[model samples]
Target: MITYVYLVCKSLSLLFSSSALDTSIITYDQTHLKTPRFPLTDLELASLYENWLVGHGKTYNAAGEKERRFEIFKDNLRFIEEHNSVNRSYKVGLNRFADLTNEEYRSMFLSGTMKRVKLNRMPGRNNSNRYVVRVGETLPKRVDWRERGAVNSVKDQGQCGKSICVFMCLFVSFIFLLVEGINQIVTGNLVSLSEQELVDCDRSWNKGCNGGNVDYGFRFIINNGGIDTEKDYPYRGVDGTCDQNRRNRRVVSIDGYEDVPANDENSLKKAVANQPVSVAIESSGRDFQLYQSGVFTGSCGTSLDHAVVVVGYGSENGIDYWIVRNSWGPNWGEK
Candidate 1:
């Protein structure tokens, strides 16, 4: 039950949206967080909870006793929440879990894997940076004196009868409120994106993942020391010479090949129409290659002068690849 609640709270935003809710978007800057920003109906929250966990890796475990397991799992969830929100240095205490019944949720707090841990040394900086000074010292407070505690207060320690659930609900609710407030204050419009779009936005924001050369168009924006072809061939220029010249740089993508001779066999356009928007067409060297593989992993063309994400994918000659979307114009590269 605790696991269900945790999952529900996490997945609620994925299931449904009002126009206001749908418009909510989470940007991926390191300073920006990615939590649901709106309230969800019970059913919508439940559906998202069930599907996302199943999709990710928190499935039911079969190795442990049914009754003893959920408590441990719930403890794990509590630990993670506390670690992220309250305890910084604490490693996540629970990973493995078994399927549990509702009775397990009620009766499983027995063998005590769930106790509040008072951390002496805080791990990293919390969202805030002001340090409390003592007398004339300039250093921040020592870990031993920082005085942080879990949500469980004194009255909570000796509680009984639905007390645990009440505390659990309160803790989760507080996190929801905090995250939503942060989202409303900092995140941009997300309603314009569907699930797949959200995923793409995240990928694009990954700094290390931009592994290919920058196209001349993109280079204009980031060509710090002019073109370093050895390290910068695979990328497309974004805010470069063209933009400065008051001309829209020619954008190259599978979308512009309307008059090009398509094999009618494997085509990038077909890939996009079929798969999730996460698939895309990528350019290989000066040539074109289809990048139809699904999200997370797919092959870009070899010896790639530049690499771009395929927002969609399909097949040609039974060869599967992606339909890459690039910032470069139609005249920039191959069809």
Candidate 2:
């Protein structure tokens, strides 16, 4: 069963017209570019058996299930090969989402229920502060919190619609480490914060395993003093009893978080230059779903249905982009 709801909104401003002229090309080292390997036709049969045995290709003992998965894998491979065949600004390939159809893929993987809260804007303030690049204020061409050792490995949210919880956990955890200084992260003393604790325990205004706002989650952290590490309150995906014993394992507290003024890409860049920042952007487009690697100058909409983290920003082949860290898992993008 597959379902989809097409959202009609403003087209992404990423794909630039010839009239737009401020962007510069940014290049990456060839060695760092990851080209995903898809299953070859010659080895498909053998790979299918291996995958089935490992509980991947099939579920029920029903006939034709294996064949269905194989066909799906071939479709995925064809999509990748076709997209990469010609030179493009970005690359696309088979990841964990390879086998699912567009509808199934969106339903299972991109189910973050983001509430559209209208932010109150102050009168006369431009949507954002004017862009002023300070003297000697150059940022790195690229920055990944994972490389800085402040971010944990990419986490799979599974079938749970709790991406809000996951992003909240990632945001708070990384910010805590950033405030504690790089020494703790370098010394391996930083703890992986618990998303499950937020899932099960954050009852102020959040629904466990359903979805919630990041601001509410942050307020929960502030009122509760802190949140537990992943070791103390492991992720169960589904809602569970909030373990009171694990509450004492809190390691960091959130004072508060400020929202970047709406549609302010410049402010977003500066915020990310300092630390990873949680962001919600429209990701229901097929182009976003198939994103494999490189800077994603999107064909995305402005509906803002999903939450992601902006780890850095840079240009690729004259297109400026945000280096987004997704929660779909390490297999989904450049990990």
TM-score winner: 2
The digit string of per-residue lDDT tens for model 2 on 126-202 reads 33343344567666675545556655554555544454444444333333333333324446565666777777788
Top candidate by lDDT: 2
For model 2, where is the 10-residue window of minimal lDDT?
A: 1-10
lDDT of 1 by residue, 219-275 (tens): 222222121211112222121121221121212111100111133322323322322
For candidate 2, the TM-score is 0.70
lDDT of 1: 0.23
The C-alpha RMSD in Å for every predicted model, in order, reads 27.0, 8.7
- Per-model TM-score, in order, reads 0.16, 0.70
